[model samples]
Target: MTMRAWVIKQYGKPEDLVLDRIPVPSLREGGAEPVDTLVKIEAVGLNFADEIAIAGRYQDRIEPPFVPGNEFAGTVVQTSGSSRFQIGDRVACQVRSGAFAEYCAVPSHRLMAIGDLPAPIAAALPVSYTTAHVALFQKANLTAGQTILIHAAAGGLGIAATQLARSAGARIIATAGSEDKRRIARENGAEHVIDYRQPDWHDEVKALAPQGVDIILDPVGGQTSERSLRLLGWRGQLLVCGFASGEIPALKANYMLVKSASVHGVYWSFDRNPEEIATIQQDLVGRCADGKISPLIQQVRPISELIEAIKDLGTRNTVGKVVLAW
Candidate 1:
């Protein structure tokens, strides 16, 4: 059988993703063979990382002629004998690749049950939500009543952090690039929103949280990284998530010595156990169902427009997550 997929034939631009009909993956499993679970993809989540991978800028190595998506949601169609998931189960998961296809052969361990949530919501949950959860709850140990500053407050990760922080009872200060994004951030439970593109953005953050923010979730790591440290209260944490600003900022150790502040780097995908991811996924699903948190979907297009959708994400013109529905 044949399936349609967005293949990365060569690393260049978003348009380099070529749609091609490829054979459906086999469910064969044995010793030394990967345990595969076949899923008919219903939705695929797009991230800034997708643009990085396509442009050959990501630190991870990617060979051409491979699929370039990280997260997906679908129904299980077939499974290898070693798998616990049965056919027809609704699920979502993040893979190293192979998600931008009509069907994906994901390993059984990475699969997370989506319960009754829609496919687009499930697809948007994995990477962004996981990153936010781990950064706030695990790394920073954010507590209720504390203040948090979320950079890029209108982007996928920023929106996730804003919602999670609000659920935790933390006072949120969200920084976006535009007024529309600021409004979106505020609607997502951010108590304070600032236009980060303005020169006096951090001034607003300072006035809002006079005691200094207890935590800062920074994905834009250029000048924002260094500036975020100034906003941190004593013993506060500046969680380093990514360098979306195209420059990685450096800090001096002496500054931390005086302020007693620490910089924690959060790499959500590293050293993660499948069981933990499953638990996080379940929690996020519950939150979504209860309306405590939501997957902010900015656009949903057909799988054939995958390239154009990716291009839109690359331009950083959209708010929240961009999804491709099959």
Candidate 2:
């Protein structure tokens, strides 16, 4: 059987993505490490990292002629003999690649039951929310009454962090480039929202926090990352999520020395601790089930429009998570 997929014949631009028919993956083909489940993908969430991977700039590089996607929602159509999931189970999965297809062979460990959540929303949850949960609680240990500054505050990861921080009883100061985006940040949970495009944005943050924030969630790098250091309170932590600004920033050790600040690089994919992953998964799933947290989907397009969808995301023309429904 064949499945339609977007394949990157070569690394370049979103325009370079090719829609092609490929044989559906099977669990039986797993040489040494067998895939546990075969998921018939229903929806796929688009991330900034998807574009990076397509352009050959991501940290984990894949050779040409590969699929470029990280997170998806689907139904289990097949499973290995020892798999925990049965056929017909609704699931959301996170993978390094192969999500931009009609069917994806996934390991049981990467699969989370979707329960009653919508497929697109469930697809959006695994990556952004998982990263936010780990970054805020595991790495930073954000506490109640603490203050956190979340940059790109209207995007997927930003909004996830905001909701999670609010649930933890932390005060949120969020930054986005425009008023509309800033409004989204406020709606999500931000106590204060600032336009980071302003030259004096850091000043605005300082004005809000006064003595500086307890934690800074920085996905927007470039000067934003460097300037965030000035807003860290004593023993404050700066969680380095990703460089969505396209320019990586250099931090000064002198600033860290004065504030006794710490910088933690948060790469959720590198987290191999099964117990920790299970804990975060359970917490996020429960929150979603209770309607305490919800993913904000900016747009949902057909899988055929993947290029246009990705282009909109790359240009920052959309907010929150973007999903391609198959």
Candidate 3:
């Protein structure tokens, strides 16, 4: 059978995405590992990573003529006999690619039962929230009463970090490029928000947190990453999440030496520490179900408008998560 999908014939920009019909994927194709569940995709959460993948700049690069989405929600229509999930179960899943299509073949291990959580919201949880939880607790070991500075505080990952930090009893200092975005940070439990676009934004952060923040979650790289090093307290940690700013910073080792601080690169991969990831996923899913934390969705558009939706994400014109309903 055929399915409609946005195919990238070549790596370029969002405008280069092409809507095309392709065969529905099976459990094993092109020698890929067998995926145990087949899902009729209901919603997809768009990330800046999608844009990065489209431009051929993402860390895990894929060749052309490939689907470009990674996180989604769907109902299971097919499953291997030994699969834990039965047909008709609703699930949230993450894949390396192929989420932009109407149907997706997911490895059962990457699938999480989402219960009654709305599709868009379920789709929004896996990537951003997982990254936030892992970075804050697993990597940084953020403690109660500690201070955290989250960059791009209005973006999906930023908002997730803010919410998680707040729940952990950490004081939050969020940074955004605009006033509206800054306000979003505050609404999502940030104790203070700074206009990161200003030249002396780090100074402002220092003023709010004289002892330096205990943790810095930096998704906006380049100068923002460099400046964040100076904002760390004694033994502070800077968690490098992504380079949304398009420029990777060359951090100075001297800053770490002076503050006795550490730098950690945070990236979520299914291949590493399966048990730990599953534990994190289960916790996050339960939190979402119980309303302990909410995924902030800025807009929900039809999948047909994927290009426009992704363009807004790329331009930094969006706040929180953007979902595409299929």
Candidate 4:
């Protein structure tokens, strides 16, 4: 069977995401059953993880000439398994690879049933929403009515975290990059939005949370992370998610000691913490269905413009989730 997938001919730039036709993969000995599933790919969500794979940056290295996407939403047109799903089930799945395709096989276990939300929303949820869910609810143990701050507040995961935290009754203090991002952040439930590009954003945050935020969700690294501690409240928890800013930040040891603040790291690799993943998903999935956390999808560019979308995200221009359509 013919399978259409976005192939990275060589890891370098978004231009390298070339559309190509390849053979549909069949069941391997260890792979799950329902081998013949046909996913009419409706939407493919982009992640900073994919950008790293494309530019040869991600720590989880993959060989060239492979599918680059990690998540997608589609209707399962065919499946051999009858226990969990019927022929037509609209679902969003988390996978290590193979989502950027006209048809992809999702091991039933990795597939999570989506609600009546549109495919675009469902497609956007799997990665960002799940990651945000893990960061806020699982790792940080955020309580309702408390306050938290999110970096990259208008990006895919940022918006998800903002909405998720807001639904939990936490006052969201969002940090964005531009005016557009600022608007998106506020609309999504940020009690206050600070543009980090400003010279004294740290002061702005300090002014808002004189006592410091209870939780700090940081993906931007380098100096940004170092300065964030100044805004931490007593016993505040800093959740270190990534280095999207392209620099690793070093914190002053005194900051941790004096404030009784703690920092935690997150590496959403499949090798660790399977059960934690389930609980996070169940919570956010329910919230999404109830319209508690609405996704802010900025654009739905076709797979052909993969390069453009990647560049937009790299420059921090995309307002929210940018998806690739099959």
Which lDDT tens digits does candidate 1 get at residues 67-99?
A: 889999999999877787899999998888889
Q: State candidate 2's TM-score.
A: 0.97
Question: How does each model score on lDDT?
Answer: 0.87, 0.90, 0.90, 0.81
Which segments of model 1 are wrong by more than 4 Å?
31-33, 270-272
Question: How far is 206's C-alpha from truth in model 1 (Å)?
Answer: 1.5
What is residue 145's positional error in candidate 1, in angstroms? 0.6
Decreasing lDDT order of the candidates: 2, 3, 1, 4
Q: Each model's TM-score? A: 0.95, 0.97, 0.97, 0.93
Where does candidate 3 have its weakest 10-residue lDDT segment?
27-36
In the range 1-326, model 2's lDDT, one tens digit per residue, is: 99999999999999999999999987863465558899999999999999999999999999999988999998999998867799999998778899999999977766888887889989988889999998999899999999999999999999999999999999999999988999999999999999888899999998888898999999888899999998999999999999888889999999999999999999865336766786677678878989999999977899999999999988888899999999
Per-residue lDDT of model 4, residues 1-326, tens digit only: 88777899788888868878998765332443444455667888888888888888778788887888888888977665433556788877777888888888765656667867688888888788888888887788889888899999988889988988887899988899778879989998898999898889999988888988899999898888999977889999888988889899988878888889999886674447655675666566677888888888766788878778878888777778988786
Measure candidate 1: CA RMSD.
1.6
Which parts of model 3 have CA positions greater than 4 angstroms off?
Answer: 28-33
Q: What local lDDT does model 2 show for residue 315? A: 86
RMSD of 3: 1.6
In model 3, pairs of residues that clash are: none
Clash number for every model?
0, 0, 0, 1
Error of 3 at 321 (Å): 0.3
